[model samples]
Target: MLGKLLKHEFKETWKLPVLVCVLVFAVFLATYWYLGNIPPAASEDEISMAAMMAFLLFTIAVICGNFALLIYLAVRFYKNLYTDEGYLMHTLPVTPRSLILSKLILSSSWMILISFEIFFTIFPVMERFFQLLSTDPQISLYTALGEYISISEFVLLVVVSVIISSISSMLTIYASISLGQLFGKHKVLASVLCYIGFSAITQIITSIFMTPYMVSYVITLDTTTAAAASFQFWEFFRTILWIGVGISAILAVLCYILTEYIMKKCLNLD
Candidate 1:
């Protein structure tokens, strides 16, 4: 049942992400081809530096465009989840658990895919740019990725961040809409009000608790110079792991309960 639900959800949500991927690829190809044949008057190192800077600028532009598309996708998903379509959606043979599961899984999966698409989409442009500047047979063609930064950890962080952030955002929307629908004859306004209310409550709670919580976590870590020198990468991961996982679990359960409540108790399809 969850699988079937996800299949339909994927069908509905895939278009925008796929189109973004295509556009990113096209941009990369165009940049690569244009820069490849254009001989620069500058020395090899200068040309390399210029090409790298150009790639960075282009990347920033693409990321900004990707963010806009992400906003559109989020709005579309929210509308599909909240409006009359949800009535028809909930009427299916599947339970609320399955429906919620589908949305979470599908949306999270796309988030991960988008993360990868962003990486691979830029690789060709970068690769070609590097090749154009390579002048020596001794100089290996493989890019010095490590020189910039340790990308493995960064990549994992990005993937987890995207999935967690997307799901969390969706949960807020679902909870707001659910709370809103409880008010008769003012469902839309109710939703907006609920969202604002939720935001205020969240901010208050976070403000009151965030500092103490972070301080406590910091205290547990080694403060001594010796311990500080011995700090491990896993330490950072462990610190954030529980918080991220806990928030994910909390939001998942909240989305489920609120969605179920809305479906069973408050939903009035027009």
Candidate 2:
């Protein structure tokens, strides 16, 4: 049952992300071709000029493309949340838990795809732009690629952080709507206001708690001696990273549970 639910969820969620990823790749390839085709000029500064133009174009593509993709994803999510289609969803033979799990899984997968599209597909092009700007040819693209790959651990951690953040954001919206609809009237306005208020409060609390750990981490990012003393820099980072991953996983589970509760208890589509 869960497998069937997931199949449908993935089918529903896939098209937009795949399209966005493909568009980003196409833009990148076009930009790469444009850069490669530029004629030799008196000053190699022309290379930098071409690279800068490509960078700007790629940035615009990312911004506009990601915005459209996210908007589509959000519209689809909300539309599926409340409608006759949602009624069919609710009446599925599978339990509400399976339904919520399916959505959560789909959401997380899409977020991962978005991250991969942004980083893997786009960053290499930006790296090429940077490579063109650099002085030494022996300071080759391989060097840049190696440096980027060496920090893959940090990149993966950051990706996980982003996925968790996105899940939390969507869960908060879900919770706000659930809370609002519990009221008989003014549900939309109430939801908006509650979302704002809750977000403010949550941000304040999170800042207070995270500040110390963040300060310590920032200090560690700089502490070459400390990095050498115990674990290597990567190992030191990994220790903190596993802790973060654990917290993120726990929060994701709780968010899914919260969404499921709302779907089963407070959601009123009629």
Could you give candidate 2's per-residue lDDT for residues 96-125 as a string of tens digits? 778666766676566666666777766667
TM-score of 2: 0.72
Name the lDDT value of residue 4 in candidate 2.
92
lDDT values, one for every candidate = 0.65, 0.66
The regions of model 2 sitting more than 4 angstroms off are: 37-50, 140-152, 155-159, 162-173, 183-202, 213-250
Which residue pairs in model 1 clash with each other? none
Per-residue lDDT of candidate 1, residues 86-190 (tens digit): 667767888766766677676656655666777666666766666667664244323344333356855666567666666766667667777776777787788
- Each candidate structure's TM-score, on Cα atoms with residue i matched to residue i, is 0.60, 0.72
Worst 10 residues of 1 by lDDT: 140-149
**Candidate 2 weakest ten by summed lDDT:** 227-236
Clashes of 2: 0
Pick the lDDT winner: 2
